[model samples]
Target: MGYINIDFTAGCTNNKWENLLHTHSIIQLVNTPTRITSTSSTIIDHVYTNHPENIVETVVPKIAFSDRYAKCITRKINQKDMPCLCHKQIRYRCFKNFDENNFLGDLNKTSFTQIEQIIDVQSATAMWYQLFLSVINNHAPIKMKRIKHVRQPDWLTDEVKEAQKKEKCLPKQRELE
Candidate 1:
């Protein structure tokens, strides 16, 4: 079995727990700066590894969704070829640049007289539908747009950002007893 790592969200300032873990040959790999809180500096989260050599680096990113800073683990692994795929989506025209009067005028200019002249009912219905579609497509054309996905919480607001900034500014503190 490989080494396992755990993160404790609750503020843990005591070094005694680490000593106990080390006594059992468990090594803690969270080597970043001191954990910051709104009130004080503490190491709430921890990363433990049985095979320390496998861990290349550990970092606590500034951006996070909660009070606990995100812990990132870097390890050496064999590289393999990966396929690059493009993800595209259709973006329909919005009313922002659409002029109602111009759209109505365009619709008025559409000729549907040929639909009534068709002898077959199916042909007339198809012609009428095609005319309607052509008018709409000319007015509100759909466009292909590519989107990049970002890892961010939907509920993250400006207030939460401010708080994260404040916590990040907290000074590095000495190991707690």
Candidate 2:
């Protein structure tokens, strides 16, 4: 496997991670490793600014695996009018806050004070639900069963070949004319 080292020190001051920009005909893989590491400077900025390391670790992984998770999230949120943040780093920030609030699971009774100190329950519930929707958007399950075999290759197995002899034997439509 090849790894690319992203050095923040090499970035221009006032950098907005513009050097990592990619022109994509399909935005499905926006969070892939190449795309994510392009923002190494921003991640380093957060680490130096005293943000929690857990947040950084969690977010960076998501950004790096853009082909897997990024594509999933883009489709889940639909190709409609949802804000861009709902599919990008902004989603990570939202998840961090939601996790801190224990949105996926409840905290132990002893940690009630800790929960109160970090986040309020009122926003916690709504934020938690929003994050849940984000996950659903990004990780939509592939429904392979729903997909019919629309085309078959000539080189496929015997059963497939038996199914469509005409595909190979039929006259070429362009030549026929």
Local distance difference test, candidate 1: 0.62
State the lDDT of candidate 2 residue by residue for 1-177, as single tens digits. Answer: 112233234332332334322222211111233333433422222211122221222233454334222222211233456444332221112232334444334323223333345365644444444445455433342222322233434667887657446434433432343
lDDT of each: 0.62, 0.33
lDDT of 1 by residue, 1-177 (tens): 112233333553346766788788987666553356677654455677787887888887877676556778897654454333455463544455667788888878989887777887755665676677577666676565665543346777889779656534432211110
Cα displacement (Å) at residue 35, model 1: 4.4
All candidates: CA RMSD in angstroms?
21.7, 31.5
Candidate that scores best on TM-score: 1
Q: How many residue pairs collide in each prediction?
A: 0, 6
* Candidate 1 minimal-lDDT segment of 10 residues: 168-177
RMSD of 2: 31.5
Error of 1 at 163 (Å): 70
